[model samples]
Target: MHMGKSYQVSAKVDEGMLASALGSGDVGVLATPVMLSLMEQAACACVQDCLKEGETTVGAQIDLAHISAVPAGMEITATAEIIKIEGKKVLFKIFCEDREGIVGKGTHLRLIVNRDKFQQRAAAKVK
Candidate 1:
């Protein structure tokens, strides 16, 4: 996808998504890993339309800060904007917010790959 293209994905925090429930922390709130998944979900949607059939994007790296805690039952939205594209690599600026304001922000890197080929490579690792 070209630079500046953007997309958003939202999710409601629940007991299953909490830090205590996910075992990421002792406190009851949104977990960092879950927040990052939402961010990656947004990034994937942002470039879905640009991919050819049998192609998909996989997360390569993520650098983010979970700046605030979102308790259960609150909805949060993550927005991803394409900041740069280098060959098969795509870089995105990500922001996650709750009803009040921003809760997280960071950058993510994704690499485009043929879906079947990528799956095959991963499956080969089990052999």
Candidate 2:
């Protein structure tokens, strides 16, 4: 993947994305896990066009801080920019924002893998 390239994904906060609905908290704001998923979705989009057939990236790690609460009906955008690439390990600077301002920021790491192989390995765990 090329360093500095970025991608964004946006979604409106809904009842299902709320902390109360997701069981992450008792409040009605956005859930941290959902925000992280958005970040990961943006990260995946960043390098999707560059991957070869059967190759895909998986989230390896994340360090995030949710600084603001976003209520349902608000739109939030998550951006992921490639900061570093070491072999198949890609590091991204991630951010989440609403119309008010930044709601979260962090770093995320993704590892490139063969999709079929990864799926097979995961399925084998149940056998």
Over the stretch 58-118, how does candidate 2's per-residue lDDT look in tens digits? 9899999999999999999999999999999999999999999999999999999999999
Clash count, one per candidate: 0, 0
The residue pairs that clash in candidate 1, if any, are none
After TM-score superposition, the amount by which residue 69's alpha carbon in candidate 1 deviates from its true location, in angstroms, is 0.8
lDDT of the candidates, in the order given: 0.95, 0.97
lDDT of 1 by residue, 1-127 (tens): 6899999999999999999998999899999999999999999999999999999999999889889999999999999999999999999999999999999999999999999999999999998
Q: For every model shown, what is its TM-score relative to the native structure?
A: 0.96, 0.97
- Looking at model 1, residue 40 earns an lDDT score of 93
